[model samples]
Target: MADPRGLATLPPIRGRVQQAAPLAPFTWFRVGGPAEWLVRPADMDDLLLLLRDLPDQVPLAVIGAASNLIIRDGGVRGVVLRLAGKGFGDIVLEDDGIIAGAAALDAVVAEHAAAAGLAGLEFLSGIPGAVGGAVAMNAGAYGAEVKDVLDWAEVATPRGLLRLTAAEFGFAYRKAVLPTRGVVARARFRARPGQPAAIAVRMAEIRAAREATQPVRARTGGSTFKNPPGEKAWALVDVAGCRGLVRGGAQVSEKHTNFLLNLGSATAADIEGLGEEVRARVLASSGITLEWEIQRIGEVMP
Candidate 1:
């Protein structure tokens, strides 16, 4: 997928760009195919340059921690961007808020914020995705969501760099609508002073609760379906007689019915197919449709 003409003319930068790289190692499921081209920009400047100069016809997509994504077995075409190292891994504490880069892990941000005697961000400790993904998904747990603390965000739009406040994000439960012109570079979160040790204890409790209820140890995306209003998805799956149900190597987790586990050898198709079957069963029995939490990307083999 490399452009020979552009490759020669484009001045070399400090970033590393690879062609036809396998994406399995970067995703949580440890499955899926390769990316046509992968770019790890040196920093925000490097990212902007690449975005500006790249051909408009070439496809592009960005991934954060990839905790809730499926890239399919056939792989993704064109350029796939992943920020890493110094460029997108910073966490800074200010007198008023915290500034976290796009690639910074949620747990890392949560821990640092707690250590700084900050409240309101403890809920992030249990989320496993990156900060950008959390914002994009409006990720929440334990009665708290990211929107509650988001002060502003820095995004690299097609027009240029822009700052968006909480109101500009138009956040809803588990969803945030960006400008559609570019990607989020970082976010600033507001917090209030709290006891550091007490906050740490609360975070520990959240972590323990997550480990107890979720298939965190299994090879699976966090939750297969979003909860429908007042009811939980797990309860619905269980009542529909799909608990512990197996299709190929994929099983609806007995530990947590909402989570589907890849039992050692499950293919992407197997996992996805089983999820669909569960959704169908739940809909037939309960008369309510379950929406997928995991975002499926790329195409299936023909």
Candidate 2:
């Protein structure tokens, strides 16, 4: 069977669409293949139209900042959407809450909140991804998670758009149960007025702590695996002797054993392979199978 929904046969879209777009530059690791079809939507309405009109067989994936992702070697099979621009990067202070577009960087959201004298979102300053990814994964750091602050999120579904409350998402440790192909458009996070100086201090401390413990300047995906219940992933990686382990041009960050880095010119295959190897070693050494925190997608090169 062939793809029935090629770009030539698609409905009209106001956004820019490319047949194949290089995705390596979109991610932090910078070692993936291209997106078979890349669509940069103009705004939330444009995305909703695309989602509603596209055939169900046409696989849909959205990338926002692309911080903790792995696109496979063979490239994505269908449409890849990158929500950007003022359409999706807008942030506004609304009473006791912050309304952030999906493409709004987590750090930016935190800074905005801090500047507005809102507290409880300082933890977001340490998360490297965007609001959409954070909502998708319930992304957390230090002590708080997205579930703790998310009031509701507007998601573009195949049928139309929906505003789902935080309780609707079955959020867990580093995971969230969402619709099969839901694309988060924007979200409202509950916050309370606090001292601006205190919030700034907290954000600064988190930033410094991250720099001291993690390879913040390196081209690496944040954390490779989620810490198992009552167990740390980095400690297990260290015990398995996977720290600084290398496969092709990919190496586990010695500074932070849980991080996988592309030592320039590495293929996505090498990075994925190294991650599998780490999982094997950790399992063998501790009888605990570490689950990936990073989302891996697309196909292996044939």
Candidate 3:
């Protein structure tokens, strides 16, 4: 089905807007179809205005970095907003914390934080998403999570712009409870002073560790499944004999069982199918089901 809303009826804004924009290039999977309406707002005000004036019946979605997403073959309906880094990727160091725009890459944040001698945000270096996606999913790595250091966040909600405290987010493993349609605009995180040299060393260690264990260079969605309580997802998949398991052009990463990789020509269906296959096999073997950590959006082709 095509997008039901007419772009002509939408409010004017200072941004780049397109109809039937290809979404594959925006995502890590390098697969999927197009977005019915793709809007890259020039700034937060532009985004807010667009959100406030958008038709309620017309769905809205936001994608950042697209590091952990799988867009389906049939494409997404309605307006899909992508915050450009040039406008939303600023990082400011405060007296006691760091403020980052939603579009700032996590690694960049980590590097900046280290340069400013800020500790405790070093874990962000290992996360492959932008600040918005990190907050949306409560993205974590190496025992630290966004919730642990987040002071507050500015979000664009239907009611208007609102400042939400960390506690209000109701964070959980790999998830954050946010307004049904809220868009994170910026976030401020609390950090403490530390030696820049020490912070850099820690960040470097994290990078090395990640590179050694993950298929960081492959066209793959980071982690395919969340670790079930008390059990590692990779171990479960490995025990299920799913390591290197293949479906179409997609395969479970031999380097990391929790990751699913696209071997050159995998479609969205192939990648998702491989994940489901891994989930099924894992469940059948361990009686514990694996939950997908990757956000699979859009619709399947008919």
* Residue-wise C-alpha lDDT for candidate 2, range 1-302, written one tens digit per residue: 56576555555778888887999899999978889899998988899888888777788888888899999988997889899898999999977989999999999999999999999999999999999999999999999999999999999987888999999998999888778788999999999999999998899999999999999998888999999999999999999999899999999999999999999978999999999999999999999999999989888999
RMSD of each: 2.3, 1.2, 1.5
lDDT comparing candidate 3 with the true structure: 0.92
* Segments in model 2 whose C-alpha atoms lie over 4 Å from true places: 1-7
Against the hidden reference, what TM-scores do the models get? 0.94, 0.97, 0.97
Can you tell me which runs of candidate 1 are displaced by over 4 Å?
1-13
Residue-level lDDT of model 1, residues 1-302, one tens digit each, is 75653543332556988878888788887777788878888998887777777766667778888888877888887778888888888999986679999899999999998888988899988888998888888888888989999998888765667899989889987889887547788999998899888898999999999999898988888878999999999999999999999998889999999888888887777888899999999999999999999877766867
Clashes of each: 0, 0, 0
lDDT values, one for every candidate = 0.85, 0.91, 0.92
Candidate 3: worst-modelled 10 consecutive residues by lDDT: 1-10
Give model 1's TM-score versus the native structure: 0.94
List clashing residue pairs in candidate 3. Answer: none
Relative to the true structure, candidate 3 reaches a TM of 0.97
Instruction: Please give the distance, in angstroms, between residue 32's alpha carbon in candidate 2 and its true position after superposition.
Output: 1.0
